[model samples]
Target: MDEKVLLGHGSGGTMMRRIIDEVFFDAYGGEELAAGNDAADLPLPAEGERLAYSTDSFVVTPHFFPGGDIGHLAVCGTVNDVATSGAAPKYLSCGFILEEGFPMEDLKRICQSMADVAKEAGVRIVTGDTKVVNRGHGDGVYINTSGVGFIPAGRVLGGQYCKPGDKVLVSGTLGDHGITIMSCREELSFRADLKSDAAPLNHLIAEVLEAAPHTRCFRDPTRGGLASTLNELAEQSGVDMVVDEMNVPVKDAVRGACEMLGYDVFQVANEGKMVCVVPAEESELALEAMRANEYGTDAAIIGEVLPCPDDRSPRVSIRTGFGSMRILDMLVGEQLPRIC
Candidate 1:
């Protein structure tokens, strides 16, 4: 029989220690978890007055998807969230909810991924907990991550900071993560050459901020994808926004898949990509910064914020290659559930 998780593993006794030592600690160890304390003792940023803290949970179905698994998504999701605020992520806490009989080997794989990704992003998995539920009561594994970083003084970024003349940019191709998840589902099994764009983007965002200090904001288009992200920003700033459909960078394979699946490419979720808004003059600077990073080679300026004409409510519009215009709106209902 395959070695599998058992409820006893979470009993906080010898079995729990075995799981923590043989699985989690063996995969990733640091000062925090090694201390064996109830909570991690952390230090404050040396200089920055503002701190960025974010938390998120991952429960994507088919946890093992192309290009990324739940472990990668869990770490990247929280790290990216902190980085979007122009902070360099420093620490992370991960919690796992695992099902009984879940393969121990698979758990090891996920834990190792979390370690490797956290290392690359320069963030430490400082603390964590593991719990196993009875069979059929929980998914194979669900990860929750919380991250923290320090934002330098005088740095302010948010959807509300958007201004007309600010240029909108994306780190790379869109729809890769969403399409990959959809294609790999057993029921559909839609074949495509797509992989989840899940990645840690702290370094990439750092580079962008370095090149363009006047950046208005950064947002990861995860759940609602590009359309919803832009619309949210437009509404926040009370500014209309416009984009040329052709300017958005999307992989041909993803586009083809979306066409076949009757999905709007703009509304698909992404894991590793970020949408940046910068002042017009700093647009090229930001784009160049993104291109310099491995994760942002395909970065492009996709659109610009516009003054709301006649003081109308903020809205986002896209100009098609065919010369027609359409309002870009947030997804009303679920469009691909359980997609990270």
Candidate 2:
């Protein structure tokens, strides 16, 4: 019960749970972080294989958006996470928190959207739960989705597997989701027609893995976007990385909006884009596989990993088109709230 809590330490034991209950619950009567799990395989009765599991909660302000809704996002987010571990997502459980007096028609629409996207992704919603909160208590609706998938035999992928000479590839243009959400908000309304890139990447990932069997890892840049994701990878692999600014695919509208609003495009959130790190030799194979997918037509190989001396700390830097380099640091604080 006397354990110290860090920023990213998920509560899986009594210590962090105690802290949440004591501090958070005492203040709000809710312990949100009492339990959580990362995207990793869970041990099961099966011997030669394992199942990858991941869970996510969606509370996007605008229940509906240009490209997707909360229900669609809930499924894609969790599915993508499980897939990053080289698993073929199969089943999902959805839980909905609906506000009293919420429109049944909208609820029905969101549910249908979930079904459509789920079917498209080749996954099933096996079970679900629903609860209604007081009229003013809940925001229209919130969804939590948990998924599991079976990892193929003899397949292992993770950031820790990255090494020098690995190539970095992005599924498509960045910041569309974050910027789209921003443009949709009524409070700070902006004129843009960007759509949320919230789509299941399981199939695309499957193809990439098939083509590039030696891939180091796959990461969907969500809340903290590509910069944070790459920083975490660099630290995990203990290697340096050099990303070319011009090589990264950021849509013109997104780039312009970020420039005008003073936001780092690299730090913008993405719901449907994935970051892939593979061996230099098979990088093209990975690129080809990604480009073949509908969601990854704009995929590009943006950078390469470099050796980091034992005495020097690993770093991620970006090479500008103007012949200069600057450190690409991880996002420090919340850039946008409830972005995913």
TM-score of each: 0.97, 0.85
Ten residues in sequence with the least summed lDDT for candidate 1: 185-194
Residue 57 lDDT in model 2? 93
Q: Write the per-residue lDDT of candidate 2 for residues 77-157, one digit (tens) a residue.
A: 999999999999987777667676666557666777887788788877655545656667778788899998888778999
- Among these predictions, the greatest TM-score belongs to 1
Per-residue CA lDDT of model 1 for 1-340, tens digit only, reads 2399999888899999899989999988887888999899999966746899999999998889879899999999999999999888999998999999999999999999999999999999888888888988988899999999989888899989999899999999999999899988844545546789999999999899999999999999999999999999998999999988999999988899899889999999999999999999999999999999999999999999999977578889999999899999899899999997
Q: How close is candidate 1 to the true structure, as a TM-score?
A: 0.97
How far residue 205's Cα lies from its native spot in candidate 2, in Å, is: 0.5
Candidate 2 has an lDDT of: 0.83
